[model samples]
Target: MNDTPGWASPGSAPSDGQQPGTPGASAPDDRPDDAPRPAAPTEQPGTDPQGPGSKWSKEQPPPAQWSAPTGPQDPAQTPPPPPPGPGWGNQPPGGPSGGQGGWGTPGGPGGGYGGTGGPGGGYGGAWGTGWGGPPPAAKPGVIPLRPLGVGEILDGAVSTMRTYWRTVLGISLTVAVLTEIIVILVQGLFLNDYADTSALEDPSATFSELASAMGSALLGSGVVFVISLVGTVIATALLTTVTSRAVLGRPVTTGEAWRDARPQVLKLFGLIILLMLIAVGVTLVGILPGLLIALAGGSTAGAALAVLGGLSAAIVALWLMIRFSLASPALMLEKQGIRKALARSAKLVRGSWWRVFGIQLLAAIIANIVAAIVVIPFTFLAAALSGDGVGSFLDGTGDFGWTFLIISGIGSVIGSMITLPITAGVTVLLYIDQRIRREALDLELSRAAGVQHPAPGTTPGS
Candidate 1:
């Protein structure tokens, strides 16, 4: 193992007669090519708790040990034809859209985990593409240095789960309860009001009366919703920020959290509103085109609408993600304004959008799965017991509607609450990492944590 830091010239004869770029290639890239290998993924700066910098293992493994390029890589090198069979993005490459990832799959030109002897081959990371999605996350336990996607989000979630499952569960339970309470209360108070009012009950009110009533109702609901939304966002962001601070081995005082988070409140909310606006605009545009086409007599209006909606949603989702991935960290740690934070996020996530996207997607899926397992059965049972429950309650039927509703509510609340803290904590942490990756945010975080970086030549393993 010839140990070297940073990118090396292509033709150096590594111990196994190998070249520098293809660490795990088993063979070297021809000297004529003379390109350099990408730096071994770093352990991230400011990661060492008690040291000056991260504890990076300088030992360079064989090219084979590193990921091989799975599909035709090399922007200059075109891919051979597809291997036949249902190959959409699966096509070899060289086309406009055939190749998905920089190479064949998601990550990039490198072999990645899928190619058998990838970085995560034997004792890779903690959750090597298994904790959730198609594969586990590449790096676990350590926070990323850039904006993350759902899968990475899940990996962080799982990592946090391993450490604080009980706390997370409790939080989830709390969130679930709060959510259910809010839902029930709103329905009972407002929805029930409409259900009971004669004017509301009447479907034939004049346009003026209807407009007035609707406007009144909507205004009232909007006020409440705005209040609730602001409160929830502020509360959730603070909770998440503090919990993340704690998770990252930093301060956990409520006062400290409030102090650090208070000013950033409006910034975070602004980001949220920005995202909502973008989502609304994209959805509206996509839906409009489809609707217009449908009105103009398209046979597959439904299909077009669905396609446009899905595509627009996917693009907007990705755009918003790239835009805001690292903003939380900027707000929480750098104390930047929302616009600046968002810009920081975009800057940090310049080249690695998909990876972040995948990680986040993974996180969402995990939380969803956990929530589902706990909520679905109870939901069914609730439906069975109430006037709204599935089966009509006969006089002889067990009077368990209340029980079912309460249980379901509890289950939902528990799941949401617990998941919320964990998710929030991890996501915020990851956001910090993305900034660290880009702007050495870890150094700031470490300073906040009062830790030093390891000096040169001090290997983590050593």
Candidate 2:
């Protein structure tokens, strides 16, 4: 009798008298007799009758005989047809297949190789889709209309100048020239009177004389500070508009920027004044206790109180400054009042204090570096050109003539022209970035730019 393993098809069974598990049977005898046997071959559960594991199943049909065609067969052999359904026979080496390779076919909806869905996709596989896709491409502007990195913020500032050099440079140069001229005139007319060395060299100089000199110096400095503050506010207001238009890839003239910014100039100035007053008040309050103590004749205790109070006041002032740094841009762009702008700034900065602070600090450092690069050489030239040379310049013992002032003013103008736009642009862009992250202002920006369709997840007025 045919005696191949019972699992073999009838026609393929051996023509011998051995059954499966016998010494001469093709089936291996690894299992002990007592071991539980798999389901019977005729009704094996979960096993595909035609699969590789079931090659010897009795249900399999006999193989078809191969016959040469009447004409010459093609030299290349025809590949075997794939199995009917999903299984190893149809699967590629890479993975499950509908085509070449596996599920990770290149250039498919699933990104190249194992990537899930191109750049739009977050990562790979089901997990990537579940997590959602990446943010949409930012529209062109001074910035990319997204959460900005520090480098991008800095670049945006520089780009504002490069993109709109004439308007930006004109505004800055006018302000710088006017400011320098005013400063030089004030010094030459009033402040320079007290800069004489005779008063310093006089052995009989009284305390009142010294007090008068200090008071004069303070007054001059205060006047200069006020002028500088006014110029800064104007620059900031105008530049805020420039930056806004630049962000939308729109050109803005100095006239247009000035006109738009003019309405908000007073509000911005008020905001600056309010902030300054708050800072000054806080510092004064902190130092008041120490001043009282000192006046009461407790020198050591007064000194200690002064130190503690100053430190406490400084901390509070720094915190508030950071919290409200965006107020200028908010006021200028939104045309909000002092209190509203302050509130808006506080809201935007609520959870991003450190980030804002770090960026502002870095911008300040960069501005200073740029200023130094321009100013340092001019300082040396001024000193060398002065009749008294370096000694008189360093010691402040010689008169600073028109030549020194003019040369230094040139440097000041150059430095201001570059630094003003950068500082103002960074501030505006920072405000916009914060809004984009916290409030999705990019939608409004896109709409304003005449974008026909908003990106996914962005709704109108949202």
Candidate 3:
């Protein structure tokens, strides 16, 4: 068996004279290019001149130095210089100059990681590094300063609650308690009369009596609705400031949020009222033709026309509502008047009608689902505790005493406490997301956060 290393064996070692496969070897003019030439081996001290296996002897002299051919030879027959070693000819291992795809080299159509001047250039290449920019500058806030996706929006809302649980939950709980109390009071005072629907089961009941009952119910509901709306507005206003500060990674007290939001409350209120008026006006206009027909005579044709008109109006109202959904946030945050906020919302939502509508609808659905999850069990428990079964409670056939109302109101409060933050947070984030996408609001947010390197030419707060 050969004891020497495979490379140092006679078959592989470079001979003293020009060897067939060594750098001094000549190439055939017609031969196709072959593998790259190997670099000349440097002589190591203490190595035998003949071979690694040979022992040094007094008679043997050191190996002679390698020398280049002095005379000019046929250009076609001369082999190219041996390839340089790693880092020897300004080429890093596995780098571009090494003829292997590596960092800063165009790996393919879209440049690979760190490649430049290609379709996919920069970090992770243009083919998408599976992320948008670098992991957004560490977010100390509820959300990162970037265009948000649905999951991110939801996460941010949750993050706000998690990061500032005391303030967020306190605000939500207070609003929920107040709203629920008002609703319960209204129901107790005004809706008690309609709580018993036994009159409707009586054969002696007249259409006028039924209409009167409905009217009373409507009146009570309207009052409660107004109160709830006011509570929601206040909560949203205060929470918007909290959320805005949260985006900058700042913690806020309930008092701080209240103080910041108070100045804009009236403006927010006016904006809400204006929006309601516009919605009501649109609805009235859309249903006017049908209303006039129905009032003239309650004929089948009139009923059909009324239905058609009301349907048309409802569609328009829905569109308008979605179109101006961001107005409240804009009004509160920007301190703009109702008209300007409405205009701002309209501009942001102009080209993104379906997108905004879909996101809003999804958020509403999620909120409702969450509320139901929290409220349904309480409702059932309330019914059971009140001596009414679930069926009777759901059917509204059982007597609804103060006990039942209070228990149900507790459930409502709990549900509201949980859902209010989520819904309000989602709405605010959606507004910010739209602005980030359209207006590059992330740059402003970054500047506000004192990020070391904000997008160039972007002034803070601009």
Best by TM-score: 2
Deviation of model 3 at 417, angstroms: 0.6
Candidate 3 structure quality by residue, lDDT tens digits, 60-171 = 2223322235645677997865565432233222234122244333334434344422444444332232223333343647776766778888888878878888998899
Candidate 2 Cα RMSD after full superposition onto the native fold (Å):
11.1
Predicted model with the maximum lDDT: 2
Q: What value does the lDDT take at residue 352 in candidate 1?
A: 64
Model 2, residue pairs in steric clash: none
C-alpha lDDT values of all predictions: 0.53, 0.74, 0.71
- Residue 317, candidate 1: Cα error in Å is 3.3
Off by over 4 Å in 3: 1-138, 194-226, 387-389, 453-462
Candidate 1 has an lDDT of: 0.53
Q: Rank the candidates by lDDT, best first.
A: 2, 3, 1
In TM-score terms, candidate 3 sits at 0.68
Off by over 4 Å in 1: 1-178, 185-236, 296-310, 387-407, 456-462
Which of the predicted structures, 2 or 3, would earn the higher lDDT when compared with the native? 2
Sort by TM-score, top down from the best: 2, 3, 1
Alpha-carbon deviation at 127 in model 3, angstroms = 9.5
Q: Tens digits of per-residue lDDT for model 1 on 397-443? A: 33333555576676676566645655565556556556545665544
In model 3, pairs of residues that clash are 120-126
Give the TM-scores of the predictions, in the order they appear.
0.50, 0.68, 0.68
